[model samples]
Target: MEELIKRVEELEKNTQKSSRERELLLNRICELEDLVEDLTLQLKKSKKTIRTPVAPKESLAINNASKKTNAQEDEPWLFYCPKNKPYEEILRNLDFSEGYEITSSALVSEEALWTQILEKMNEEEIPKKLTALRKLVSVQLSSACHHELLIIVRGIPGNENPLFQLILPHIATLAEYVNIAWSEVENSNPELLGRIALVLECEQDLKVLSVDRGDTRLSLYVEKLL
Candidate 1:
């Protein structure tokens, strides 16, 4: 009976040892699972970090250029008639750069001239086909038949008010252009022709230009004649 009791006690110890061994094995498996999960997360992060390929410098430049092109396309008007507005004093000013043009060729009334401009805008596919009147200051309209006070005009694109782009800082340059153009309207004397401006004042948000003489300051205004 004593031996049997001793045997029973040994069996209990063996069973306890087996239970501990099983617990250890289960704990080890949980640890391995956790390690694998962590490694998988780290791997996913590394993949994300390297996912985006570095663009080449040339490619970046091209993309930027394309963006600029799109922007310019949306706005068909060209920049700084600065090159030509100065053309007034210089008689050779007739030599217009590419993409610039004299809106009216024949002697047309002011109202007619405006109509011609709109017609031109409608005819031309802006941006792709850039076209606008060349900045002509000294426009000669006096003729032998009837010098019925023929004249021309000049002004800034947008100064205090912007026609399209932000007002530029080059006021002096604009002034020079205005003075030359307005001079054609008048002489050293004050101009009878009223200064003009382009504005978005009304619901139409009309566009026009203005010129100041003496100082030759230039600015934009609104003309709702359209």
Candidate 2:
């Protein structure tokens, strides 16, 4: 009887030990799995960081290139009349580096010459000349003409004859001539029609008999005896 009891107790102890060993092995396996998952995540993050590190110099270069491109695109070239000798001389005399305003008389003379030149520009040269003149003169002439013509029309007290009267007839003829030239200009380049419109708008009082862009036209603005 005593031997049987001892044998049973030994058997129980052995079974408990085996169960404890199995539990310990499962806990160790779980810990190892957790460690592998953590290592894999760390490795992926390290590879990503190595592959595409941000470069300060490269970023600065890209920014500078973009700024340079923008500046080039925005900048417009200065323009001048190649045909008018006086205008050419005036432009040559101008010290653009000094940044000075051109004399009113000089600007007026240039405007008059440009008005005359516009009449002579044929189909082939109209586009080039108009583009050039827009950059040089058209941008400045509107306000200048208004102020100058007003001053001339309302002469100073000392002047015997108003300056406008002397030029009025010539101005009338020029207006008619401009109307004809603008028609040709419109036919050649419709884009420049706005410039003609601007001139007409600036000198609104000047009579424009007709702007016949399609065919033959005439201006009654010129003084006539009927």
Clashes of each: 11, 0
User: In lDDT terms, which candidate is top?
Assistant: 2
RMSD of each: 35.1, 38.4
Give model 1's TM-score versus the native structure. 0.22
Error of 1 at 159 (Å): 68
CA error at residue 22 for candidate 1, angstroms: 0.3
lDDT of 2: 0.33
Tens-digit lDDT string for candidate 1 (75-123) = 1111223323333332222222212123222213333343343343343
lDDT of 2 by residue, 1-226 (tens): 9999999999999887975675465456556766898999998888745566653332111110111111233211112222222422333343211111222122233345454443333212222232244333332333222221111111111114354334433333334433344444445544433222111111223323233322333333321111
lDDT of 1: 0.32
Q: Estimate each model's TM-score.
A: 0.22, 0.22
After aligning candidate 1 to the native by TM-score, how far in Å is the CA of 13 from where it should be?
0.3
Q: What's the distance in Å from true for residue 196, model 1?
A: 94
Query: What is the lDDT of every predicted structure here?
Result: 0.32, 0.33
